[model samples]
Target: MSSPNELPPAIFLDPWLTAEGDGLKALSQTIAERVERQISSNLSQSARRDAISRRGLVVENLVANLAIMHLSPHLENRDLLAVATAKTKATRYDREDYPKRLLSGVVLAMEELGLLIRHPYAFRERSTTVAPTPDFAATIDRQRVKLSDIGRALGAETIWLNARTGEISFADRTPLKCRIEYQDTEETILLRDQMERINAYLNQSGFRFDGEHQGPVCLRRMFLLRSLSDPHSFNLSGRLFGGWWQELRSDRRHRITIGGERITDLDFQGAFCQLMYVHLTGKPFPGDPYAIEGLEDHRGGAKLAMLTLLSRRGDLKRLSPELKAALPRGWTAKRLMDAFTRHHPALRDAIGKDYGVELMATESRIMVELLLTLKARGIGAMPLHDGVQCAASSGGLVAEAMQEVTERVLSVALPVVEKPVVGQEWGYKEAA
Candidate 1:
């Protein structure tokens, strides 16, 4: 949306995609060489060579970094691929020292070459953003630069433990969450290898949105993401991310295609609570767990309440706007929390404690096992954490496979819910 005629939103960095691209690496090198040459008179030979040869500014790596940025807007809706450039700087993930030094130089060089227009990033909070200039957009069209030209970072460090937790800044200039870095262990490495295999299988699943045929498949690569709460533990809410379908609305996602075959949406019904219920009782939830007797109509509120009660740490202070809208008028989050506990006293001791990470960890294992099962049977699945997606024709089989995997992992078979395709009026709430 760097088009001069239309204003673009300020896109903050997303954790989903790294700013790395290998396409046009040679072309970028040529451009970087020219850029250094244009400034050659300003610095002597030794200084120029030293600057260019510095680790972060290595021409090829730096330009590929730019090329990914340049190519990103084309592959994804620019809004969907928000990567924090700050994290890229001085982090273990960016071991090469790329992006720390090369961003401005690449942007300026691209501007000079009329490849892009830049809105300077306010150093205070936002990362710099860019868009291809009209000429560059035209160039992209002419050369047909595309998704295959870009991908997950080359070395495939597909597992991450992020330390910077909160997003907002405090008035006194204190960061909301102190940043920390984590070291990897053998377990994390094993998860990374498993993810690489899954990614390899999924990347070939022929993913694309409806009505498009010419780009590389999406979510082909994924990473296991966890907060650095326990750097040594891979179990702290390790979720799989990096799928394009993840960015879609449910209705829109129904349009996804694998090898041009339309897909189906399936998930474990009420999975957050179901996982606990079944694991605790050794039985699937008896009925709609969110349907508290007095709050039968407040399923959403009940859901929000149960999630906060069981998953979040500490006290319930107030209702989020979404929760508030779902509850009875004048209900407090604390009131809802109390109501949830009163109805499900079995979970009383678990309230006010953090189980979100545990749930996700368990859910991650289930999803992985489900995907592997499907893979062994030559059926493809896209990991949706508590759910998965497969060709519509394969939905029943995927659902069955998922339940079997869940039963194996948790000793209870949580029901699989089939979400109908776009035209369907209603989806089945539980697998028959």
Candidate 2:
């Protein structure tokens, strides 16, 4: 067994380790020089504040980028920074100053080194509040701005607009703006097209876009159903899944087991699934799929099967009258796959295998192509992994569809593995 000091093979590929290492080295030197100069000169309070502020800005920006990279597809700049700040603050680091500020400075330095993309929205100033109102009657004609208006102006879907002040508050809060270009290639164009189709499918199924939810309606409930139905445990521990093991070890947020065997609360798999869904649907997920722990039993294979059924073209004709009646209008196989994979690691891996796992170009193309197939078929399946499925509906259609899709996909993906019948008295058995 390798010692704790021994670096895993995946360490070389970790961007966080490389960036953080370089950042810490530079930060240490800079802090040392600054502190020495401060001591020698007896710097004024204002000067000290300025110095800290500058450092804070840098750290905030660094944390922002880290959050962006980790929380892609769904997380915007402001939200990313907020999450990063909260995460960093929860760690065992020194608390002499606002950790958010320090982390922002680190982020800024990293950006200067071209190690991260500076998200533009991170720095944009939200509209300011001029005054506060005493009561509803007094503020009735005060021209309260709706959240939608603010979101539209900022091109942000998830934002809290204060009705009285017209100030927009970001959930993933950070106050730093950096212009970063999202390179648009053929793949991005295709993904956009897929998003349009998915939107249409939802509309046809009588599921209106609820911006307040920040994702598809009833997405959380559908996810719950998927988790309940899944036979295999979605182990965050690395032992059960090899490639994911080393990556978890390097993440400072959660500790991996001493033997490099387990991880806790690292939700990259679910995050990837949500990212794929957003790419294909242009809708944010309602909640983090990785938040789910443990498992429940209640088969939803039939629902999953329906999702697979809808994903394919010309398959609609194959459905029996009873099946057709049970299925939601405009349901498609592609949408089912999209929703299933949002929390289904196996399906996510399968897609990665099919497309090649490069995030920017290759995988993006595969997701777009898959989405296009669903669009062509007029199916309303949302993007998900292999073992799960989901869709937006007014009532029980979401649950029903998920159950149907799960069964179909599992039967095909996880065929029966037979064990030889052992003698009643035999303690050990040998493979035939």
Candidate 3:
């Protein structure tokens, strides 16, 4: 066993184990034997081991399900392996070899079979860093099918991946549409079932990717599923952070339609800023949370600054050259901060004081409540971080749900900004 300060030994990964190589059956037996040894009770060890072995199989099944349905098919098999073999975050590495005990043997076995690939460095890559040539790259599609069969044997009933293309049904086997370019992690696997459930629900509830847009409606798709994650503290607010919608052009979003009726976007004006002000002052945000008294011309910067402050726990550096070039004149980070402080003195003083995590938690709770409420009403709604969208006729219900959750959780009702459907004029007024 290594000391607490020492790093865990590197383990090469192969998430999709080959049938001829270190196969699933051998891996299962190994896990069972290891788990059995961990059982310390004097009670009939064989019987207890058998029961625990069944549960371990269930966990293995779940992992396979995640790989087939939720994990991005665009990623190389080695990347997924990296997630499973990644280092532990727990502090008791001095005494316990939890992660290594679970993975090291399987990794070595796979390495011997020529199916494993070690990361270039000790740590896992955040994105698809490997560009394996054809000779070195394993058949990802074949591996997916093999994993799916494993899942099926373990009782997973969903058939989301195509047999040949290895694509999820949500994007209709379209390349790159369902690709998860992010790093492989346990959290990524944990989110797969929820994503599958939601995608299944959307398909069952009459949601379709309308193909009338200039881009592939599938690629230019508007996925309504929550990533269940965010950089601002990993909140589950149904934020479109990683979805294709975030990549959609603003002019083209209005083209999203459901059942032949045009869909409209409903925004929450200065959402995070308003939430922070309300949380701190116990009073509604004074009109236009983004409009600072001294920076009226730089509403964009004021909004951006407010977001930057509320979303993180850190000091504000004056705008970098890259950031400065992206914004209009007079919109430096320093100027924006000054304006933000002037307009909302109490809230400004509270920025970057370790308040972001709680705010995110609160926001996530409220969004989950709203989404559940809408789901119960049989009205399909797409979350937009701060607000959600349904049919315009069902707009009132969506608004009511948003307000209810906000008030119930925050004890205040912030403004809800609604955008009208194209060729119509019925959205909430934009904050001046």
Best-fitting candidate, scored by lDDT: 1
The lDDT of each candidate is 0.61, 0.29, 0.47
Which candidate number maximizes TM-score?
A: 1
Over 1-432, each residue of candidate 1 has an lDDT whose tens digit, in order, gives 333224344443322233133435445555667776644347677876767764224444433334444454334545221223343346654545344454456456656777656665454544556665666555544555454554344453566654435454453321244434567778766777777777778877776665453233323222223343544445656677766566556656656677677777798988888877765666766777777866888776787777767765577786667667878888876678777876777777777676766777788778877777887888877677668778777877888888888888987788888866675444434566
lDDT of 3 at 399: 73
Ten contiguous residues with the weakest lDDT in model 2: 217-226
**What are the runs in model 2 whose C-alpha is more than 4 Å off?**
1-179, 208-370, 384-432
* Per-candidate alpha-carbon RMSD to the true structure: 5.6, 23.1, 13.8
By TM-score, rank the candidates, best first. Answer: 1, 3, 2
Residue 121 local lDDT, model 2: 23
Clashes of each: 4, 64, 0
Better of 1 and 2 by lDDT: 1
